[model samples]
Target: MVASSILSPAIADSLYAQSPFHSDQHDARTGKFWMTSHPTEPGDNGVVPLMKHWGGEVASMWVRDTELLAPLREIGRPRIIEIAVPLATTPDSYSAAKAVVATFGRSIGAIPGKGAFDLYTNQALPPSAVLAIHTEGDPTFVAMGRTYPTGFVDVDAGRWKELTGEDD
Candidate 1:
């Protein structure tokens, strides 16, 4: 994991919505709503195009781990957003991690102590994986998750609570 920064969910949401490729569509196969990019290829999910736009080589998973939230909290950033890219080799993962850190770490704020940005790459991820943005205190914002064919840019509040069983 590289040292990284933080962004409030509101800011993240705004940035994502303002992105040129944003989309909101319901997946009939999974019966879920997604705010994501349009598919780059016909009959293809949006993962490939999203990764390309986001500067990731292959499909990746972004998770917010509760365990890593402490260090960020100490700096007054109680929320964390992680990006996990899947690669074919360990070296590739490391390089990708560095790229992610370089590309996104600066725009957000840096972690004060020990640099707790946890960006990694997985070698075992299946095709068309979902990437999620997880936060600690904000239950109203659950960015995205897998169990679907395409990647997601954001998810609405009602759907988030419905999926996670979280109360407002």
Candidate 2:
């Protein structure tokens, strides 16, 4: 099924304003800032899945659940959901991780079933930087969180990997 929720780019920027999750406006291909990483679900203990996980660093810019539900209705609000909120970030990946210390409540690995990850933005409309979720069949779940000023794509993968990983 398709996602009911849609992230507005303008709104997402405000959410991560001054934060590190900010992506490079310039089109310079350095690292996999826009690629997928393989990792088990959050809290999987060890075994990370060989799934291509890709998302963004900004969000819908809504602090309250109400403001974020209209778009949610479009996707039927399934049981299992995986959320990733990009926080502030530095120039490099390693530095970005270090900056995340000040931010804790970012990126959530939720569990929601009967759906899949579909809602996305960016030039290619692929998930990047903020608020990402998907649910597709069996095992309903939802993990929603926001990162600090320092955030990176890899770090985002490792932190949320536990949703389906076995190695703590």
Candidate 3:
């Protein structure tokens, strides 16, 4: 089934801006800021599904849930930025993943059903981007094609903790 609620870029950006943990960097390659955040509190444990927002269109990964901490442990606490694009209408389901590949003209990585959100990128991402897909359901089912950002910058864990008062 398709998502009944679609978030506008302005609303998304406003919500993102409200978070002190949110940050973005100017991407010379795309000429737009790539945003990321550490949106969870320390000791927060739960399954975070994968979601994608391209331009203005939003899509949820077929997989329902994934470990939230896996990516942080694997990627060394990089700024978890939101992926935003100009605007486009893309179908949901596997087509969402395909749309990302088509937009970037390259193969994208897929986070397995039981996998953590651990994908990272060393390059600048296209306007279309991925985020933790938040949803409710069983966490043990097989996942369809799901993609995440291929580029991300690492952040200092100690400094982040100091700033946010989050104890590890």
By TM-score rank, best first, the candidates go 2, 3, 1
Candidate 1: which stretches are off by over 4 Å?
1-74, 82-84, 89-130, 140-168
Pull out the clashing pairs in model 3.
35-81, 35-82, 36-80, 36-81, 37-80, 49-133, 55-85, 55-87, 121-150, 121-151
- Local accuracy of candidate 1 as per-residue lDDT tens digits, 85-163: 3444233455445545643644475321212222323244444454444443444222233222244322232544655
Candidate 3 at residue 135, lDDT?
27
lDDT of 2 by residue, 14-128 (tens): 4446323345632443232332222224433321111211122222222334444344334332322333433232223443343433234333433322111122223322255
lDDT of model 3 at position 119: 30
- Global lDDT of each candidate: 0.34, 0.32, 0.31
Cα distance off (Å), candidate 3, residue 142: 2.6
Ten-residue stretch with the least lDDT total in model 2: 47-56
Supply the global lDDT for candidate 2. Answer: 0.32
Q: Which ten residues in a row have the lowest lDDT in candidate 3?
A: 138-147
Off by over 4 Å in 3: 1-10, 19-47, 51-119, 124-168
For all predicted structures, in order, the TM-scores are 0.17, 0.22, 0.18
Candidate 1 global lDDT: 0.34
Candidate 3 lDDT at 61 equals 22
